[model samples]
Target: MSLQFDIDAVLDRLATDGWVVIPHAMPAALTAELRDACLQVWQQGLFHEAATGRGDGQARRAEIRSDSVLWLDKVATLPAVAAYNAAMDDIMQAVNRGLYLGLAELESHFAVYPEGAFYKKHLDRFRDDDARTLTTVFYLNEAWPQDAGGEIRLYLDADCTQHIDVTPEAGTLVLFLSDRFWHEVLPATQQRLSVTGWYRRRGGSVPW
Candidate 1:
């Protein structure tokens, strides 16, 4: 059974730790469905090599990141994508109500990190614009072995002195402040499947 969403617990963690990981945040059946969708889309050749930066300033640099991505549209008719976005709507409402974050919109995409793929440590907010206020990564890989690595490292400071490494287990949700934390995906021995997204504030360039 899917566990109920715990808004208070999530909010408390965000306030104190600046990040949180919720196990079983999503239903197993939904995750399986989404995983199938990801594979299907990938087979359809819809995913692209992910790029960095924002707006006109973006470019692909393999050294910085090496994941393939397929962005999800809120209005998409795809059942998996549309259902996921609808669930996020309630969460966003709760976040804005509890924290007054002024988040105006959200964007999400399927990210597939092949074996040996990794992303260099960086904040989610663009340097030229502070529109992205929060970030979320939802894992859809079942039986993710700890030894398979692909763990996400969240640095506690600007210099990476203290940090936490999290396994990308199926149904796991990682949430953090976009500009306040520096994080990265470590090279994985196995493929990693996830949906990464951001909540943006007003006046931010639409995160298409």
Candidate 2:
């Protein structure tokens, strides 16, 4: 699998804007493979309704987030997943070199948002824990139309008065400071697929 994006460019934007969106970040072939792998596992009923919070605090809250997720840690042996992991590692190292964020590792999962599903506005970092430093999302839906309505609304201010909407298009990658942004997934007309993950510092909560 080939990673074709400019690391320096991405880092520059992350440093200045606290977020960056890249289209066609991965090769089409690799993106297709990853999408297929995600769908295959999902079809086998491997995905579970995503929950809110962590550990004992975690619970299914459909009103908060209505997506299904399958953590990548459980399927690391899959070729597409393994490739994606390697690519992430490369980017992580680049981030450390450029930003000195001290990101130790990444934890990720395939998130599938079915029709009429949505995630309410929220920050990625937990209220009591701040280990998650960076958030990343890679979209896998090809031919996604503008009217599909599965866009991610990223708030530009704490008050959430200003925001930008991002369409979930194939081979796109989005990165941002986990604790800095308030974002949400809008309800869609069809299935929306993505691999959502976070990079954490040492001694942070495990991704599982």
Candidate 3:
């Protein structure tokens, strides 16, 4: 995947609007491989119902979000997943250099939202945990139509009025400041697939 994006411009967007979107960030072939990997995981029953919160508070609640996820290892058995992890590591270095963010690691997972699945608006990072500094989501749904109804809506302010919606299109990448934005996944008329991840300030050689 030799796709390139304006890294400086994207970082500037993160500084200003707290979020940025890059269409076709991943190469078509690579995106196809990733999509296939996700579907394979689903078929193999490798995903678990997504849970909210952390530690003891973590629990699955269908009412909040009905998605299945398989957390990705930085060094995955799948070649495509390994390539993406390496790419993200490079981007992470660039981000840290530009912002002086002491990001130590990243954790990612493939998420699937079936029909009638929605996630109520919420912030990725809790007020008490500032460790989660950045969030990234890459869509793997090819040819997602406008009326397919699954769009991640990003609220611009505390009141949740001003917002922007993004489609679940293959190769599209979304980056945002995790603590600043409030976002939600709308019900999908069809299944929606994506790899969502977080960059953390946590230490050690592994992602927390």
Top-scoring candidate (TM-score): 2
- Candidate 2 error regions (>4 Å): 205-208
**Which is better, 2 or 3, measured by TM-score?**
2
Error of 3 at 90 (Å): 1.6
How many clashing pairs per prediction, in order?
Answer: 0, 0, 0
TM-score for each candidate, following the candidate numbering: 0.94, 0.97, 0.94
For model 2, residues 1-208, the per-residue Cα lDDT tens digits are 3459888999999999999999998889889999999999999999999999988999999989999999999999999999999999989999999999999989999999999999999999997778899999999999999899999999999899999999999999999999999999999999999999999877765543
Top candidate, metric lDDT: 2
For each candidate in the order shown, give its overall lDDT on alpha carbons.
Answer: 0.87, 0.94, 0.87
What are the per-model C-alpha RMSD values against the true structure? 2.1, 1.5, 2.3
- Candidate 2: residue 39 lDDT (0-100): 96
lDDT of 1 at 105: 86
User: Ranking under lDDT, best-scoring first?
Assistant: 2, 1, 3
The 10-residue segment with the lowest total lDDT in model 1: 1-10
The window of 10 residues in a row where model 2 has the poorest summed lDDT is: 199-208
